[model samples]
Each structure stands twice: as structure tokens, then as C-alpha cells.
Target chain A: MTLAEYKYADTIHRCFRCGYCKFPVNWMDVNNCPAYARFRMETYSCGGRLWLTKAWLSNEIDWSEHLAQILYSCTACKNCEEKCPLRFNVDIFNMIQAARAEMVERGLVPAAVKEFLENVQRHGNPYGNAREGRGEWSQETGIEQYQGQDYLYYVGCVGSYDTRAQQTARTLGKVLLRSGVSFGVLGSEENCDGNEVNALGEETLFEMLAEENVRKFKDLGVTNIVTLSPHSYNAFKNDYAKYDGSFPVLHYTQLLRDLITDGKLDVSGGMNARVTYHDPCFLGRWNGEYDAPRQVLSAIPGIELVEMEKNRESTLCCGGGGGNFYTDFLGGSENSPARIRVREAATTGASVLAVACPNCMTMLEDAVKAEGLEDKLVVKDVSEIVGEVCGIG
Target chain B: MDIIACIKRIPDTSEADTIKIDPSQMSIEKGSLVFKINDWDEYALETAVQLKERTGGSLIAVTVGPKEWDDVLRRALAMGADRAIRVDQDMVAADCHSVAIVLAALTRSLPYDLVLCGAQSEDFGCGQLGVMVAEMLGVPHAALVVGLQEEEGKVRVDRELEAGILESYTIELPALLTIQTGINRPRYISLGGIKRAMKKELQVMSPGELGLTAEMLAPQVKLERLEFPPRGKEAVLIPGTPEESAEHLASILQSAGIF
Candidate 1:
């Protein structure tokens, strides 16, 4: 294969292996990349993955399951983009995604990734759950279907299917009700936001999903969307524009921040608890809105908001981005990024680990259990926190 | 060698709660249900595709269903099947013997050294279609095949038996095999691949095209009725701390004579 065949051919060779992509903002450690953190090898780091991608494109290496696992293990957290000192740092994550696109085109991805994508393709969710049951979580919550509402509450796949994430979905619905926003949900009609599909490098499937969703939204006259997961928010705000799906989208935290500031919802029934917020990579580094969730948490009376050592732009990913939550390539080890992140949250001495993304909620919740820190830390979505303080369900 | 794989499309009823008996009492309600290619047939397609990859051959996928069933054929084409053929018939209510007759007639018209089918449909695990087709085609066959390897004019296959036992046999050319799950991991069929496969050859034929008629496709065994299973006792939730819940569960089990 020639260099002309690859997307980033000209800039691919510019990486001199500076190794800073493996470190957090504080430069305290070389394990910032979740895959690198799990394997403790240079091959799993951003620089290592870029080099491997170059080799594979240039025919220096053969495609293997091990190589696919290495490439798919990247969480697309943008921590490398956050920490890399090179001018080409912005394209680092995209380069990896491009490589994955090549692997996907060759049908050479890992088995679990294949399962994940197939599930999403067949069932409109990663769990292979029935699409008929997508709206069952909102049955008792009294959330109406989306119909020319001011804001279409777009709960992505994880929030719609996963058992635990469903609670956050409902809580956000209840919280939205308390805020008196003219919002409605898509319910069973909602489709996968295709954020993870794009991240996983299935560009065709992603485009199909985006086109279908954009058509559906346009038909429904949806002008605004507030998403439960930052993954969806990032997709709608950034990737969907190419398909003429440029809607005014907000992460739920940003909506809640405005709701709190405008006194639209009362939180006088606040309960005392020390909380530390984990910035979802999509919301923080991917979109740059770190202060909204913190401001919302700070507005709640009797709640103490703390920050972990690696917060904001340098936050440690829970290893759930880029479809990793479902594929789980970085799972089943002490060195897993979720386990490492919960440990970091625990070190801050905060009892509550507040998260703004449903993916983070599920990942860190399981990590807390695996690390046996259930008694020390509890993972709660920021919407659930606001629901409690506002005395809503 | 040329291979022909038989596949079926069935409603995804994995979620038990979504299943409801239709008013006709002969079929389950599919109003809100999603459909996919049968799980076992996916294994068969993978097996056929792998065999074709190993030896130079054409893999043809055939299904007996209505036009809505073209989705599974497209998926087969996406999984590297060289061509697809759909016998336009609604065989959902047809007996396995009748379906087998249709498949046998279809397979005879094509040039194939080997024919593959899933051990059974996920909705109805009769496990008889492939063997019946083999009998109608007058060829040697194996069922519950978990492993397969191709040789000159013959193939060796491992058949899974009762009690985790495996039986092996070598069948000569022009044979059939019923593929079991875990035979091979099916490759992921990307939407892009499926889009490309849409441009491939997908031929539709009536039963007459295979030289078959209503008389030859008569069902030998008939489906009586469909009914939901009786609901058992509601599960008792033991709510407490772990130790307390464990003790409660133990006492409940002890009282129930579960030891």
C-alpha cells in the first residue's frame, strides 16, 4: 500500500515519539491513555498506536487479532490529544479512528467489537435488547413522546437499555419535569446517536444512523436537544453537522446548570455529602465544558464539591468511551482505567463520585464494586443528585 | 467445490416478556418483535464461507421465505456468499419436512459439492430439516457438526453428540451437514459491506422454477397450536444485607427441602 492510500499519510510520520501523550496534565504518570494504563506498554499508547497504524498501512505488519485489540482498546478519551505537546496532537485521535475505519473495512476487528457493532446494527442498541422495550423505562415516569417539544430529551443507547443507566434516564426526566421545561422523550422511537459508531470507526453505519436520526428529528420539528450522555451531545454538536443536523444541543449538565442558575428548580432540600465530579471525556476534552457540571454541583446547598488530582481536561477516563463500555477490551484487570479512576476518586476522600455521563455512571459503578470500594464510594449521575436535592423522583 | 447454505429468518424472541400468542393460536405475535437471520444458520453460513475461503469455490445462500426474508439473504451475501437465492414462500407455518422438500428441490438445481444448514431453527428446534433434505437429495450427511475441514472430493466433520461427546466422519462429495453453534465465529458484516453486497446477485424464484408443486410440498407433520407456558410461583425477594439475605435464602431453601 502506498502513502496515498492512508488519510493521514503526510502527517503520520511527524510523531517523534515524544511520549507526553501517555501522561496526565500534571505529568505525574505515564498511564493516562486507558489502553496504555491497562497494558503498561508503549504499543498501547497513542504514539505506539499511531506507529502501528503507519506500519499496517505501509504493509510493514500483518493484521492480527492482537493488533486489532490494541487498536480497538483505545477509548477515544482525547487524553492523548489533551497531553500531547506536538502540533499534530489534534489529529491523533482521528488517526486512530481512521486506522480503525480501515480495520472495519477489512472486517478484521476483534470479536467483542464485532459483537458490539452487530448488536447496535440489529437492535439499535449494544445489548441486543428488544427495541420495543426501549421506552419501558419511562412507562411509570409519565414522560411523553417527543412531539414538537422545546427540547427533545435524547437518551442514548446506554441510558435506554442498560438497567442502571435507565434509572439515570428516568431521574433526568423527572428533574426536567421539575424544571418546567417543555421537553419530551423519543421513547422507543429514539435510535442510537451513532456517536460510538463513529468513534468505533464504522463510518458508514454512523452516517446511516446520523441520517436516519436527523430525518426523524426534522420530521418531528425538533429544534433543540438535551442529551443524557455526552457521547450523544458530542455527536449532535460536532459530527452531525456534516449531515445538516446542526441543532442546538446541550449536555444535560449544561441544561441543569442553567435551570439552577435561573431558579427554575428549587434545591433547598439538599442533603449533605462530599462529592467529586468525573468529567466525561466527551464533555470535557471533546467539547470543553468542564465548568457547567461543577457549577451545578456547587449550587446545591449542603453539598461539598471536591476535585480529584486529575480533573477537568486531565481527567482519567473510566475506559468506557469509543464503544469500550460494551466491548470492554480494557476490562477484567486491576490496571483497568475504570478501576484506576475509582481509586483516584476514592483518594480524594469524597463519599459520592458524581458523574455527568451515563457511560461513566455505569463504568465507575462496576469498578467501585470490583475494587471493593462500594462502602467507600458510590457512583451517582449528576441528574440523580439534582433530583434528590430538588425532592423529585 | 461449490457450496450451498440454507438459512432461515426468525423473529428475535430472546426477550421472553415480548412474546405473546397471536389470536390465531397457531403463531406468536410479531407486532413489536424484531427479526434476524436464525442464530444456527449464521454458524452454517460462517462454516460455508470458511470452507469456501480454504478451497476455491462459490458459496450460494438459499432461503425459503417471503420477500421480507431478503434481508437475511443480503446478510449472507455480506458474509462473503457469492450469490443468494430466495424461494418465495411463507414457510413459517410449514412443517420442517415440507421446508426440507423445498430446500432439496432448490439445492438440486444448483451445482454444489456440499450443502449446509443449521441444526435447527431457534424458534422451533426440530433439528430435522438438514437430514431430511439430505435424504431427499440422496446424499450422505452429518448433523450437529461442530468442526469441518475440506479435502479433495470429500470433507471431514466433527459431530457433537450427547454428554459432550464428539463423533467424527468423512463424507464424500455431494453431501450435507447440519451446522451447530460454535462451529465457527461468524465474521462481522458491516453496513458498508451489506451496501456493497446489495449490488451482488440475488435471484428470486417461485417453487415452480425448482420444478416443485403444491402436491410435492405437502406437510407430513402439522403444528397443532401455540400456547404460553403456565406461569410458576412468583419469586420471593430476600431484601437485606448480604449475610442476612444469604441466611434468609438458606432457610427458605431448607424449608423447601432443597438441602
Candidate 2:
């Protein structure tokens, strides 16, 4: 909207609008693009959207209601960007969403995205609970008296508040205890990392969150951030720089892997379940962290690690990206595709479903439960698995 | 000790092209997925190699994927996995639960003192298999292991607990463990390791080889849809200088009763 803003958008101008970013032409099967899959329209594809951006810039297409809908229709999955010949980044889709969100704030936002944003701001979470006890998992563990010193584990909003993901937090704590790494947690005062706000293009609220967190980190002398959620990691890794706050950022998987390799942690006995891993979009695609968690799985004796058909770079969206976890959409069920992903992992004949990010854990766990596969498939975090195996009871 | 590290091949997440979605016609675009080591598992492999050097163990790497994953397995070998295994089949059923079943079965067929994995894979985020495998094998397992020491006929581990809390556990040998980052500095596979891994054995398996079946892998879960979360509007930036910003922040917090 401003000259400076135009300069920022210029970096994205090099996109050739080629659709190759989402899929290769030689794909023998499997039609990609969830949006295109749903709508059967080029406007929903990354190429079409990129062209729309170009059109807006060239004044060929006015920024109108139609344009706003086209922008909002994107899930910000960034999958389309992969197939583009020029590798045009699809984060622009998110940027467009953010820009439109700004207009929506001025009573210009289409009637569509209004309720979802309101819920997040009011609830301090997307799930619509004003007094959502985010740190309830820590309470359930009954490990209330342990005063740890080496690290301060920050379970993002999803991990702490989301009931499904809380199991991961508790499991992580238990695993860390078994491994003997002194760590602490903020029983309270851990607010949202402003990730959803920031990603929603609400830079102002995001900054408020950044400043507040900087204050909290400094107040607590927080030297390191151990997060279980990649969404939190992305916010910490990329957005924290905006506030000039730098700390050692490690996904819980990365840190735990290091401990296991250093002769600081040990495993005893073996397991009899075939297992596969699913990569979270933020941890894998948003950030290039692809090794630590699997390495941990592979380190165990007698266990086999398997890959999914859509894995790592080619992973399917669990319908939770860009705060989709909180919104209501009439499209296909959010839990079905991710459940299908879980089934893909299940198809490997592995008994356990492994994951890293809390959001993914929450979504997939629900999918598993919804599909009534709880008895056949057990959902566990890498930390919980390791904790149980460390022989600490 | 010969250490077999189980790894996985996955899509590259940071690059935009790697993610896929089922289209209207149920067609997946080709090459949209770029394969790599499962993000967390790569860290596990690096950790295993490092531990092998320090504690004296041979690192064997393994993964279950179509034969296309041989390159990634080879890359793991290049990264210092002494040996690699590939479950080369259409692993559509390789969800957290089914994969665990297969892995548990395969591990029973081999001999190992320890096992390691990333706390969770980046995609699924289930974070379960490590413990579930331990449960299935009846092995004592630990996650978030930041420290470990093998002593006289026993293993001692310092786990990274939540809230910065820690507790120590000691276990007997022949156990499974999933790793967390920051436990140790994972070493990059030197060119020598890569070349050396080339000489190592890389084996493959099918569901039948692992005694697995689709009936046993009935997906207990399903994702109904994938869509962007709703958004209301842009944040109202109450801009000011730092001091003014603080004052304004205080007012907002006060108004919201946060302070």
C-alpha cells in the first residue's frame, strides 16, 4: 500500500506465475492442489494466485470483493509453490491474506473471515475458551515440586491448551525426567506466541506479543526456548528477530536427540511395533529441520522407521495450517485427509504413529480417534516413547 | 556395539513445492514432493553417529519407503549410518500406528543395545512410536534424553523434563530411546563417512517380509478437510516510540486486565 510496502512486495515479483511449484508435469498420478481439487479453478492454484497478484500490481485487476475472496480462499499451505518451475514462493498467498485481513479490519473484510479472527483475539486461543487453562497438562502430571534449572520448556498454545497436544507435553516432561536433564516450565504467564496473529497478517498484535515475550524472557532470564510446536519455533526463529530477541531455539526433538547421542541418555530393551513418522509443515517446510526426530527413532535398537507416501517435502496439509484449526469450513472434513495421512502411516503396518509438532499431534490424534483406530494405533510423541523406554518407570 | 538407527525419507518442508493436497479429481501433481530424511530422524542419525564415536558403536541406519528412498537411505549412509534398511513398498499405510507395528516386528528380528529417534516427525506430530515401540517390545524407553552414560552392565540417562525440570533414570541394556535435540551436538557426516557408508549394506523389505497387512492397518483416523483458518481483520497497530509504545501497551494490558 505504501512505497516501502511496494519495495517489500518487489522481492516476490520475480515469480513467473508458473504452476510448477505445486506439482511436476510428469506426475504419473495423483492430482495435487487441494484448492484446485476442491474448486477446479485456476484462480485457486498458486499460478493463478500469483497472476492475480501481478494483475493487482499492474492495475489490471482491482482489489475488489472478488479479489478478496480469491485471496482468502488459499489455505497458505505453500504446496503449490513446490510445483512451480520458477519455485515462486506461495507464502505470498498468506501475505495477500494478511493484507486483506487488514482491509477486513476496516469493516472492509468480507463477511467470511470475520468471526474466526474475533474468536482468537478474545479467547487468547482459537478454540473459544476465555479461561482456557493452557498449562493444565503440567498440573495433571503431578510433578509439581520439581524445580528444574537447565532449560525452560515452552509448550506453545497448541501444546499447553489443546487437550490432545497436552499429552505430548506431559510425555515430553516425563521423557526429559527419565533422561535427567534439568529443566523448568512457566506454570502460567505463558501466553500465545502471537504466531497466529502474526501469520494472520496482524503485525501490530504480533509486535505486542513479541515485546511482551521479550520482557518475559528477560525477566525470567530465559536463555533458551525448548518448544514442541514448530509453529512456535517458526515464530521464535523468524519473527523474534523483529524484536531483536535472540535465544537458543531448539525443537524438543533436536534437544532430546543431542542428549541421547551424548551418552547422557540410554535405552534398554526393545519394542515390537512397526512405526512411521509424519513431518509437520512448519517444522519441515517452513523450517528446514528434518533430521533430529527421526534420528532419535532410529537410535533405538530393534525398531524400524518407515516413510509415508506424502512425506517431508511432499507431506499433505493436515488442514491446520494458518490457523485453520480454529475456523469453520464447509469443505471436506479437516480430520479426514490428515486421518488419511495417519492411515498412510498405518498402512506401513507400524503400530505407532509418531509426530513432532503439537498441532499435527492434536489434529492427527483426533483423526485417529474419530476413525476409531485407538485400539489398533497408538499416538505418542517422540518424547513420551523415549521416556517410557528409558527404564525410569 | 553395532547400533542400527531407523530413519525415514520425507518431503522437504521449507521449500514450497514439497507439500501436496488431494485435488478435486483426486489427482496428485507429480514432483510436488521433494524427498529428504524425516526432519527429526536426521537429527537422530547424526546423534547416533556421534554417540558411536564417543561410546564405540557401529551405526546402522534403516528406513521403510518405496525403492525411491534408496537414495535417501544412501544419503543416510553417506551421513555415517553403517547399514540401511528399506521397506520398499507402497507404504500408504505407514501411519504412526502401523509403522510402529512393522518397526517393532523388524527390531525383534535383530539384535541391538539401544535405539534412537527424533522426539517426533515434523509432519504427523504424533510423538508416540518411541514409547509405543518400547511398550510393544516390553523395553524400558526414555524420550528427551539430554544425557546418557553406559556404566558397569547398566545405562544411566538424564532426561530433559518439561518446565526445565529433570530426573535421572537408569536402565539395563537392550533398550529403545527416542532423542531430543540439544542432548549432544549431532555431527555432520564427513565425506569419509559418506564414502564409507557406500560400502555398507542396504536391505529392502515389503509388508509381507515384515508380516504386515492392510487389514491390520485399518486407518483408525481420517482428516475431514484442510483449509485455512478464518481471519477477521488486520491488527490495529497503535504505533509509537518505544516509551510511548510501552505506555500504550500498558493501557491495553490494563484495559484487558492483563497487568
Candidate 1 segments whose C-alpha is farther than 4 A from its true place: A1-4, B92-94, B233-259
**Candidate 1: true contacts recovered, fraction:** 0.53
TM-score of each: 0.95, 0.54
Please state the CAPRI-style docking class of candidate 1: medium
Q: Which candidate is the best by DockQ?
A: 1
Write model 1 residue lDDT over B108-205, tens digit each, in one string: 89999999999998988888999999999999999999999887889999999999899989999899999999987777788898999999999999
Model 2 docking category: incorrect
DockQ of each: 0.55, 0.01
DockQ for the candidate 1 complex?
0.55
Q: lDDT of candidate 1?
A: 0.91
Q: Per-residue lDDT tens digits of candidate 2, residues A7-100?
A: 3365456666555554523452233454544455678665676667666656677767666556555555566655554433545555465454
Error of 1 at B64 (Å): 0.9
Q: Summarize candidate 2's per-residue lDDT along B1-259 as a digit string, tens digits.
A: 5566777766544433334455642333335344556767866776677667677867767766677878778767766666778776544432677677777777877777777777787666778878787888888888877777777556788888789888799988777778776675343332223445678799887767877786876656555554434668998787876679989988998999887
